[model samples]
Target: MIVSDPATPHRREGFESAPDPRLYNDDLAPTEPIRRTWTTYNYLALWFSMSMEVTTYMLASSLIAGGMNWKQAVLTILLGNVIVLIPMLLNAHAGAKYGIPFPVFVRASFGPMGANIPAILRAIVACGWFGIQSWIGGQAIAQMVAVLAPSTTGSPVVTWVCFLGFWALNMFVIWRGVESIRFLQSFSAPFMLIMSGLLLFFMLHKAGGFGPMLSAPSHFATHSAFWHFFFPSLTAMVGYWATLSLNIPDFTRYAKNQESQLVGQAFGLPVAMVLYSFIGIACTSASTIVFGRPIWSPVELLGEFHQPFLAFLGLVALLIATLNVNIGANVVGPSNDISNLAPSVISFRTGGLITGFLGLAMMPWKLMASFGSYVFGWLVGYSGLLGPVAGIMVADYFLVRGTQLDTYSLYRRGGMYEYSKGINPAAMISLVVGVAAALVGRVMPLVSFLYDYAWFVGFFLSGALYFVMMLGHRVRRSAVVS
Candidate 1:
């Protein structure tokens, strides 16, 4: 029901033809309520599909390896997702009510052109993630090949070949576009659950029993030690899904109703995160009992499987799992960001190809180059950017505009969104303040502790600052509702 004033002309100065046909498509428009076809089940499948991936497994496994017992690891993962699902669901509101993608939704806050700044930051991270996922998928394939042909296991050439092959596979899926992705999720979702169940059984069998693994003694040794590790890991876990939080509108635009998106994500995200993180923790603990060390990477762990059949099957499961997540999380967001750069010139297909190329250029093997990069830099560092962006956006959409957007103005060259010549100084300034606070740890030795909770700090500070700045500019509602 929230929509733009239809009496207002859709055209604007400079760009006589706004949202040009060549560049514009229904995919990017503020979808009519009748056209919003996705149901709660679709949204559920979305989170269930995206969260059940190798990256998620690794997150849980890493926490376990970091000395948290299984209980603590599961608690952190559960609490983090429960916290993040708030913003994810809040942001989804505009998309469901108005049927606009994330870029256009934030355009109200950032500006017609300046929106690109935050969009690009999010896109770049997704691109890096695309490469990382492709590499993970490729590694899974290579591991399977090695089991079938042990001689080929360590060949760098083989790894690159498999990477390209998997990259091409992603490209093909993207070529077919979002509809294809939806189809993929529908089919892959059930399979993922079954495979995960099988993985759980395998772990239980390998470790001999669940009691020891579940009851594994905490490595933290003391409450203070546990808390120190808990906070950073918690932030990192939130950061894991922060990008998806910002861009969820990209998918929720198709939502049939708010109930569908909300209930679906509520059931799907937190539950899936807790379940997978539990598996990761349990499997890692079990590995210690069986293999003498806690192997965090599922790809490496599966590679160690003595039975070639199970190894190959596990690798296949990993590949399918990564594919389910990569296209949804990594490919779609960046592609939409790139397409936004020049809508008339770049379709979704073109943007996806660009994402694939950017993936190759980053050589994610290097980004995941070290455990430090994987754990702290890539996850926490990017959260500094995404968290502020999310904070400003949610504040603007919910507090400033009361979630009512002038949809037509979003595409026009000069309109309400052209605040301060296509840039909202209030939003930008708040973003800087938030990011600086989050990053102060880098320069100030005394404040280095803040670095561990960058996402939390950035989100809270940015949201508060933006709400205050916008309170002065926001058109107050007449006779506020109780």
Candidate 2:
């Protein structure tokens, strides 16, 4: 809208060639709302299941393991969800209103070519996440195998085979299509919940009672120590869902209405996180009592059970829970981003293959080596990259774009969005600075304290930088023309 070419403001469609239908068409347009079919109940179910998965469970325990009291960890997780919902809602509005996903929506501010900056960043993060989720599922299968053949359980060969097995299961379900996933999600949600309930029951039985078990102590001794851990843990908590905060449109686009997405996210995220986190914290604390040490990994905990029948059932539930989350969280966003990279050649299915292979190549095991690695390296690390992207998007959409985007121009290669030869330097440079700063904070001991607030620092700094530069870009262009 603020481009230099006078033709840009008024010229909506002067393309030398027609935009490829594969790139954009009815499927990617701001038409055909899913509003008719998606009731509030539908959204509630969607978000509920999305929240209660292996990732959330692992994250909750990681917080406690990292140093928080059980109560402190639950509160941190709850607060983080409530905070992230702000950006998630803002970003989802574009998708819900325009039916455009994240990559296209970013074209408004980043230019069509430059939009790839954030898209690729997000896809890469999702790829790493895909690996972690696959590892989780594979670990569950290994535990199950351990139940039957206790001798072979710890073999690296067995673990690698199980990992491939889990990966193939995801690929099969994906190739089978949305209807199959729907059934898997529905079936898995109930089984996952029941499994969690049973695990809680088991923990209670083993710990002697809730009163003694839930009294997990804060490893932080002093107020300074507690707050010191709190900030980073809070960042990790927010960073946990930072991916969904950006890519939520991939789901909310299917919402019946804005209200459905908003209300459902609000109602479901905090409550599910709080409740599920309680289960995690309680079970983890109970593990400390029963095992004489904390057992953060659920697979390892389940494997410790002597009864093969119960362990097998628990492993089955873990597989289903991790499987559903992997498909939804890992599969959808990266595939969409990948297809956007080369829409002509790559269909969503093809992109999914790319996502899977790249996920494996990322060697995400080192990132999840311990609860600490998972919290810091994977969760907080990716958040530092993703937070800036989310900030630019939300700021551009609401402040600069005025919540308006030309849907057609998004597909047109040389339309209004083709600022400065298909890239907005402001957006690109802002992204780099924010990401570089966050990375520096992560690795450099000098500014390492900033890593504790990495997401907040990156989000606010990038948003401010982009907004300011865009204003300056518009003002300078107007002056030169005058």
Please give, for residues 297-410, the per-residue lDDT of candidate 2 as tens digits.
888899999989998988888887788778887777888888887777776677788889998999877878888888877778888898888888888888776775666677
| Tens digits of lDDT, candidate 1, 182-236 | 8878888888888888888898988888997787777977899988888888888
Give the whole-model CA lDDT for all candidates, comma-separated.
Answer: 0.83, 0.79
Estimate candidate 1's alpha-carbon lDDT, on a 0 to 1 scale.
0.83
Q: Please give each candidate's TM-score.
A: 0.94, 0.92
Residue 17 CA displacement from its true place in model 1, Å: 7.6
In model 2, which residue pairs have backbone atoms overlapping below 3 Å? 35-256
**Total residue pair clashes for candidate 2:** 1
Model 2 CA lDDT for position 283: 87
